[model samples]
Target: MNPVRATTSTTGALVRTGAIATVAASAATMAVAAVGHAAGISLDMSGAPIPVTGFGVLTAAFSLIGVVIAALLARFAERPRRTFVRTTVVLTVLSLVPDVIADAGAATRALLMLTHLVAAAIVIPAVARRLAA
Candidate 1:
């Protein structure tokens, strides 16, 4: 009756999404923080390497949060892969807003790019796997 009959089930897909989400989040966060630090963002917090780490961490956290939420939502959606592709593409497009506004400097711009990438990495695979299910 179902086009995607419980091949993988919502729980399985969610778990897969979680794994990818966490890894992508950690990597993107670290990569951006390193770049920001190199660019001299300043670390006002407890004598850290630089204050730029906050922005990087925030960006990654937001992305991870989105993935996590989406992972859960995907569980309920009829076609999670399509939903994920749609969601990621829309968000990625939206991520370009900063560039459009020209509000971010080089470091901010770079961080935004990383955020989009990390989100895509997690969403795409999850969706595909769910669709397979």
Candidate 2:
């Protein structure tokens, strides 16, 4: 690690902020989705949207558990923001691999999408904010 690189405390703070925001954001989005469903809006369950929600739950769940996955990923030498955003985009797009490979049904597709979205939401801003220039 570079001597002038982000310090341990700075990395820790970044991860913590990402994690906290992820949980709050995921919960808020989920709650809003629930309300939207209750109000009869289209929730788009016919694709990879459902599992993406699981992504949020999983992301927040991991963050809340203090695993600091982002920190670990950020440990690489690249600039934090660039790394974070690139990784997120890659992961979100990768999450749909199953849907692309298999003739998944509606439920499966939606689940995958949900997971993808949640993961994206968690990965993006969480790392971006900290990695910001």
Candidate 3:
């Protein structure tokens, strides 16, 4: 088997795994938030109520965007593993900015931050591992 082909195949598989992991993580976050809301854990975002459906959609969309970034880094970066991990980490931290600044109460902000971290945890390692392989 050609080394390049093997590498490509591994990268493809890794990206797919990362994407799937991201989706699962995002869904889990949404489910947890929904349950919290059902249990009277208010997530009222400055009077802009976030519906369960909206939460799911937004989470999934952003997770997919992370997948795209991983794929792009795998395809284009000189050092895919390092670059992807670093980029995602920075982006993940940046993502917390909204939660921090939102007018939502402490619990809501914390939960929102948790969701972002969860998604990043799932995605960053998956893609980085593939790049290393």
How does candidate 3 score on lDDT?
0.79
Question: Can you give the lDDT of residue 17 in candidate 3?
Answer: 86
| Candidate 3 per-residue lDDT over residues 22-81, each given as its tens digit | 678768778878887887877789888877666667777887787777677777888888
- Against the true structure, candidate 1 reaches a TM-score of 0.57
Best by the lDDT measure:
3
Candidate 2 residue lDDT tens string, 44-79: 444434432654475566444333545665566357
Q: Which prediction has more favorable TM-score, 1 or 2?
A: 2
lDDT of 1 at 110: 61
- lDDT per residue (tens digit) for residues 1-133 in model 1: 6646663465565666655655666566567666655777532233333344454456556656655656655667776666766776777788767644545456555655665566566545654564423
Ten contiguous residues minimizing lDDT sum, candidate 3: 124-133
Cα error of candidate 3 at position 30, Å: 1.1
Question: What's the TM-score of each model vs. the native?
Answer: 0.57, 0.58, 0.84
| Alpha-carbon runs more than 4 Å astray in model 1 | 1-9, 36-52, 68-73, 126-128, 131-133
Identify the candidate with maximal TM-score.
Answer: 3
Count of backbone clashes for each model? 4, 20, 0
> What lDDT is obtained when candidate 2 is compared to the true structure?
0.59
RMSD of each: 5.5, 5.7, 2.2
